[model samples]
Target: MDTNDKHYRNPEAVLDLYERPPLATWPLLSLQHLFSMFGATVLVPLLVGLDPSIALFSSGIGTILHILITKGRIPAYMSSSFSFIVPSVALMKTAGYAGVAQGTIAVGLVYLVVATIVGIAGSGWIDRALPPIVVGPIVIVIGLSVASSAADNAMMNGKHYDLTYFGVAIFTLLVTVLFNMYLKGFWSNIAILLGIVCGYVLSVALGIVDFSKVISTPWLKLPAFEFPYISYTPKKIYWDAILSFAPIAFVTMAEHLGHIMVLDELTHRNFFKNPGLHRTLAGDGTASIFAGLVGGPPITSYGENIGVMAVNKIFSVYVIIGAAVFAALFGFVGKLSALIQTIPGPVIGGISFILFGVIASSGLRILVDNKVDFNRKRNLMIASVILVIGIGNAYLQIGSFQFTGIGVATVMGILLNLILPREALSEE
Candidate 1:
């Protein structure tokens, strides 16, 4: 009677630091993570005029490097960092794709420098710098900042709302929400995956999917890898490219800190100390370098994948590695990649609707769970600034490189936390 079916496993079971699901279920579990990250990962490169296939290939390798560098503890999935999009796009006009790639490598070097320091000095300062008051709002900002992107996918049709697509999105969101809340055993963990499948099927029924993409793409093809120059040449000093990317590393590092804080709050573990911030930073840096070498956007920790982990309560690094393998392999399989791309925008939107909201709610949970006193004037100010700047999508630019949205909010939150006065770790 197949009593050993993975479906029979407890729905509420958590796969934590060292835990894993049954071997048979690993691929399904891993595919959900891939689905969770796929849209945004590909979208970044598309928006910036890089090949999506290369982005997939590089992100796959980068995530693997991340898992290895982190000592296989944190289940973070690295993807194209949204942080560098603006500057990279701008640099592309003057310096071309080569310049963007160089800037990305510089960003990697910046991460390495920070990683070395964090490794030597310890992460106690990170704890002090990103207290819940500061971190909670920033994380909220991080999650909510992308709300429009999700909403656009789920509901918008061109410039106007499309009733048909909206219905599909709503249906997808409903299915995912119901499974998350009511489903039992192993099924509950894959609500997002199930939701995406359901939505895709409905989209197919409605004739929204174009079969041409799958038909036109070849069965197998190699992604174009753009290699970077390792040395300063006679023709170019390359300082401009370096300048374009290096400063933002500090900004995105702060974003990474907010991401770690969310992870800690979600898993109830101090990732900042255990695997250590140094390792995470190093992992992210290596990812960026690898991605840049392959002519992809600088890879950074993705909140979408974090939201998936938070919902599923599955933090197994093996699942992460499995997803990485799929990503890496998908890059070589043109038809398969095209098939995945054929997934309707509404389907992605519907899933993101709940996924992004889950992340935003996590930040609020940190505040409530930690009992961060909003009554305190300083805490109020910190949270307020972060929320407004982040949610408002504000950017502060200095020279060619500037902190955008999440970066600005993160830096502001940290500065406020550092400068603000407090009697003790807890208020009176």
Candidate 2:
């Protein structure tokens, strides 16, 4: 297949690679993407009882570092991973904040070790271990895994289904699809943004959009940055924290590969061979190290931003960079950051409906483009198990850390691929 031929199945990027949107619409376009990634990044820190500002700061810095490490060749964003929440919370109680810092650092160290091995041994084994049959369903799971969250936000308000909120979500989704399908020229490229604007307006009219929290927030403040040395006892080792957190790294690495593979299918460039897996892993590891030092959650390449890339069909590294800069700036402006959080859940859900669907479709496209024949039971079995396990959310809890469905599914699929004996073609 020609380069990026699979992209034809979806919309071809209007502003691909380094290209930028018009000067007038640049910030708006970037803001649209920032909205895409902001919810989960901030939510992870909040869930783990850490200050969200530090997360925004670290994610921005880490993302820029990732871009630099990859030589600006990949359009990806780094954000807080949900994987570490359980262990992070548990360790915080036993080991305290300082110990959690050490645990987070341990997680980063794991990434570095894996990256070093990849650098020395090369990334060829990645393809051998994870072929398309195994990868496609993982990609599908990545998009559909959080589907229930989207549905909950769409119709439910505080655990109860609210018809008003349901209407808002549906309306937002409708507007987004209409704009995407009907708009001409540059306007069509930002259909998600336009939809969100319309949805937010409707929410405000219905009195669901809250501004009280934004009003109380300060105009400027420094993020509460933490250092391990400030709290760690001299010459002390935190093995409990390390053991709880380090093993989870393998699962996230699996996710890292899945996300990169999704991009490879979306951009039609073999990232595994180009910038190579080692550089991405090295960049990811370094970012996580920075995050842990500053008392922020570990960073992972974000799938939400990938969803936005697929929906907008604008895979520009500049756009990703712009969003990162904006995220970092918001980390300092308490008022602005608080205000962004006020964007109602329905609006987020509305946009996510389209974004996530686009991601799942891209996964399907990979199967189609690669001609994955389901006629073969082995091919069929691997894809089926991955899909069911991932979408069903059948997770494995390792100590405090719960290995997510997609992560578990990825690992299981690879093992199945490697372990299962294959029959010759004549047998079929």
Scored against the true structure, residue 393 in model 2 reaches a CA lDDT of 87
lDDT per residue, candidate 2, 1-428, as tens digits?
44533333223667877676778878877888888888888999888888899999999999999999988878889999988888788877776677777777888899889888988899888888888888888899989998988888898999899999989999999999999999987788788889988998999999998899789989997898887667445257788888888888888888899889989887768788778898898888888889988879988988889998887778888888889999999999999899888788888898889888888888898888889998787888799999999999898985576777888898889998998768546555
- Residue clash pairs of candidate 2: none
Best by TM-score: 2
**Model 2 misses residue 103 by how many Å?**
1.5
lDDT of 1 by residue, 1-428 (tens): 22222233224338865677798889999999998899888889988988899999998999999889888867788988887888888877887777887889888989999899989999898777877887788879978999999888988777888888889999999999999999987899888999999999999999888989899899998887776554222245457878878888888887788788888777667778878999999999999988877789988888888888888888777889999999999999999988998888899888888878888999999899889987888888899999999999898877766777888888788898888787545665
TM-score of 2: 0.94
Report every candidate's CA lDDT. 0.85, 0.85
Lowest lDDT 10-mer window, candidate 1?
1-10
What does the lDDT read for residue 115 in candidate 2?
Answer: 83
At residue 196, candidate 2 shows an lDDT of: 87
CA shift of 226, model 2, Å = 1.3
On lDDT, the leading prediction is: 2
